[model samples]
Target chain A: MSSALVYALTGAALFVLGMAGLILQPHLLRKILAFNIMGSGIFLMLVGVAQRAGTPDPVPQAMVLTGIVVAIAATALALALARQLLDMNGEMRLPEEKTGKDRLDV
Target chain B: MRTLLNVTVLFLASAFGLALGWLILDLPVAAVRLPEQVTAQLEMSGVVHPVTAVLLNFRGYDTLLEIAVLLLALLGILALPRHVSDHQHRPSSANPVLQTLTRVLAPLMLLVAGYVLWAGAHRPGGAFQAGAVLAGAGVLLHLAGLLPAWATPGRTLRAGLAVGLLVFIAVAVALMAQGTLLQYPLSWAGALILMIEASLTLSLGLILAGLYLVLTDSGVQK
Candidate 1:
């Protein structure tokens, strides 16, 4: 019922959703988005915990800020890798096992 | 097998989610967030905003490494094969209204970025927010045809991109003579922090804009 509790639960849900997306999705971009979602969930949890004292604590908030920046940097790097994979194979996902596809076809 | 994997992952995720819910429900909302010493030492941090103080003063080393990480990402992107890095962008001309809006708003964003940089001393604004605004301006200019599709970052741009890290390292090293790393003389803490933030703002803007431009291209420009 409290705002902090609400945010904390939202963060938990987001983490679960993001993890599900990461595990189930095949597309590289979707994986990246899911990873970012997980990062956001962690950040949200940090901020939520920081806010438990009614006034937010500065240290955790500052850590979250640093984390957000780092997450963006990692996302940029991951995206570039995705683009490279696309250029080489013309597919975002690796060859599907169901198709019995091999590296040559990929 | 794939369906089984999916089901297992789902089950695990749900279990984790339940644990988190229970943790949240039991969390103590009332506690002393900061110790007496941390609150007592706040004045020497040279910023009234506690978050800013923690970021720039107490945990500055983390920020320095973070900027380095950003630069590493830029390097990684640039290191990609030429085919991937070199791509065509959108057409030179955009809708007239959009172009007009960009032209009107970009400069205002720059001004706002400056204000954010200055206001970080006392409020919520800081280098990251200001840098993001500047990046927004660059993206706008890119959309408006001010930045050409084939535009390679010039020397000044490259230098600007690295200036923040260089400044941070240099200052940190210089301060080693006085005492601890990144420890500004208490009297000079505010000014040094501002200088570092200013350089960081410029570099972060260019680095982000570079990534945006590279990733958003639609066609081969050359």
Candidate 2:
């Protein structure tokens, strides 16, 4: 009924959509976009929760601000890795030779 | 099976939503009033409301940390090898109409960004939103070939990227020496917010522009 609840529900839906994109899309860039979408959703949810007391909670707001910066940093690192991978191989596809297990070992 | 999964998740989510809606349906609206601690602080400070106070003073440490993270990102991007083989050039075309449009839009966009930065103290507009707009303008310029794509980012770009973090950190250190981690002792809250917003806008714009360049140069077309 409240606007905060509406925002929370919207955020949850966005998070689910983003998660689905992350899982189904194999492209690294798409994955990054999906991850950013998910981050935005979480930020929205936190802000919504902060609105519960009829005033914004500075703690969650501040945390989300920090989260946004960290998300961008992680994204930049991922982009760099993706670029290196592309350079090594002409194809943009993830290497079929290395399984998830191999990546974990490294 | 996929349909079944979708239906199941939707049903469960709806059920939860219904339960939550019912639980809060009868609660007195006044019960949700903002906490006294926030209001008391606002009253005692004789300044703006809780949100502004909290952002600039109460939890300012978090903001400073966020700026540091942004700075780290710029540093990381700068550290990346800035050598792209000239053999891999993509033929870019220039259009006079588009160039003219961009030239006109750039100044207007910059003005809007400034307005957004100034209005952020008590509104929805802020550093992030304004910076995004400014970056959009930069992207347009880049597309129009007004800006060169150097493998090495220029000194001005680097300075713009670091200014927000440096300013924020300097202010935080000053505040720490005065006792509080980021408290604006003299109650120059408006001035402090403006300073942070301006620096943040510049830093964010540069970061976005840098990211755009990296993404475009990566040649990962969708």
Candidate 3:
């Protein structure tokens, strides 16, 4: 097994872990963390793919670098929204039940 | 119904994982042969490897743009409301021991960050990594209450945020006037890379500081 393959497998494991966390965690902050973990996994996979070609592909590395910056920007915005939501609700926890009345209120 | 949804999501995820796994497994075997076109280009360029040339010169545009994105993020953060008062602000939980430790470690962190920036010319260490380290020092100070959140971002801070983008954009435009975008005139690659790396280090550090301040919602003063 090559080192690239190891990197890919590691990335896949991280992605699965992040996906599970996203599904199971109710807190917005934890969900954000899971999303970031998933993103890191994807970026790692991209880097692994880039390494597959004989010569290094600056293209994929560059794209992944761009993606990292964009991901952080989006995460920052999402965090700001989460902060606002917490300010209104007094709790960071997401409500589990959504009744008809809740839908109407929203 | 919820269980069904969960199972479906899992199945799809597994399929995706398997595809990636296959790609990884095939990569080594496929990589053993070089494409004719790539070999031809290598011969023409007289440069054994083109990746380095492309990264530092040919596609330098991408790198410059990446730095710009970071600069824009800093600007956006600065434009945001300084404090969101409604959110509960956590008080400092600094202990004397931690404060003493951070005071000693701060200088060491700064030294390491400088080393990383200098090492970026031909190695793995680069502006982003160095800036993150430097910002870690600032975070430590903030946690120690040595620096307050609202302490004026200081002139140095503002300059740091803008330097990367300004230098990159200026250089790129100058190159464009010479008939190609981001092309460095002969033998200047090292100098250009160093300048870009230095500015990027400052910009990245400022961005990290801004992010910490935004997340903590603390006034800038210590």
Candidate 4:
């Protein structure tokens, strides 16, 4: 009903979307993008929920700022790892897992 | 089978989203009023801007560790095995217009970064924003072929990269002599925050720019 609630709901949807992409996307870069999207969703939820009373809250905003920096650092590290994989294997996707009965150890 | 998995995942995701949305809607009003507390202590926190005060003062520890994390990421990238690509080594031949534009814009960007860093004390700007601007300038310079991709960081560059964190730790340690970690005396809070922010701006700029620089093909070349 409120603007803050709207933002929070949108963030929840983004988190779900990102989670799905993280599971289904084979490309490491895409997975990283998904991870970032998930992080953004969390940040949005954090600030939005904290400000649900419509008052500006500095703590969550500051936390989100810190989160943004950390997210970028994590993303950079992930990208570097992915780039190394691409250099070595000539592709960015991980080897597909054997599914169904073949995936079962027994 | 794949279709079944997709259907299950889609169904689960939607369910999760609905639950989360419902939970948000149901959340009771928070008992703690952090904004009021921040406002009450804003003068003591050493900055006019509440977010800036919270970042560099109330929750300074997070920012301190954040800089370290950024430096560590750069280190990880640097430690990756070197792969010299001949094509990467070839000098970038940028468009003359872009080059000219970069030459004109880089100085202005530096000025803006400085302004943003100084403005953080009273406004929305802060070290992170300022450093990001600086990093943007570096990326632009590289794109224009005005700056070379970093190979192994030399001694000076390494020092510059570590200086912000070092300064922050030093300040924390210095403050510890008087009280607990990072507890600045009321008199020195403003100056101390500014001093720390100035160094952080430089180091954050270097570290953030290094994130992009070291990942480039030319940077990977030994």
Query: lDDT of each model, Cα atoms only?
Result: 0.81, 0.68, 0.68, 0.88
Query: Can you write out model 4's per-residue Cα lDDT over B1-222, one digit (the tens) per residue?
Result: 766777788899999999999999999998888999999999898889999999999989999999999999889988888655657554455589989999999999999999999999999999999999999999889888888888888899999999999999999988888768787789989999999999999998988888888778766544
Off by over 4 Å in 2: A20-25, A52-66, A90-106, B1-36, B43-52, B83-93, B218-222
Candidate 2 CAPRI assessment class = acceptable
Point out the worst 10-residue segment of candidate 3 chain A by lDDT.
Answer: A97-106
Compared with the true structure, what per-residue lDDT tens digits does model 1 show for residues B53-78?
88888889999998999988987777
Of the two candidates 3 and 4, the one with more favorable TM-score, higher being better, is 4
Model 3 chain B: worst 10 consecutive residues (lDDT sum): B43-52
The estimated TM-scores of all candidates read 0.90, 0.75, 0.78, 0.94
Off by over 4 Å in 4: A96-106, B85-92, B220-222
Q: Which candidate order results from sorting by DockQ in descending order?
A: 1, 4, 3, 2
Top-TM-score structure, candidate number:
4
Clashes of each: 2, 0, 12, 0
Highest lDDT scorer: 4
| Candidate number that wins on DockQ, 3 or 4 | 4
lDDT of 2 by residue, B60-97 (tens): 67667776776676567657665355465542437788
Q: Give a tens-digit lDDT track for model 1, residues A24-104.
A: 777778889999999898888878866754666778888999898889888988987887788888788756523533332
Instruction: Give the CA lDDT, 0 to 100, for residue B25 in model 4.
Output: 95
The candidate maximizing DockQ is 1
DockQ of every predicted complex = 0.57, 0.25, 0.30, 0.56
Per-chain TM-score, chain A, candidate 1: 0.86
By TM-score rank, best first, the candidates go 4, 1, 3, 2
Report the lDDT tens digits of candidate 4 across residue range A6-37.
88989999999999878766668889999999
Compute the lDDT of residue A89 as modeled in candidate 2. 77
In model 3, the Cα lDDT at residue A102 comes to 24
Worst 10 residues of 2 chain A by lDDT: A97-106
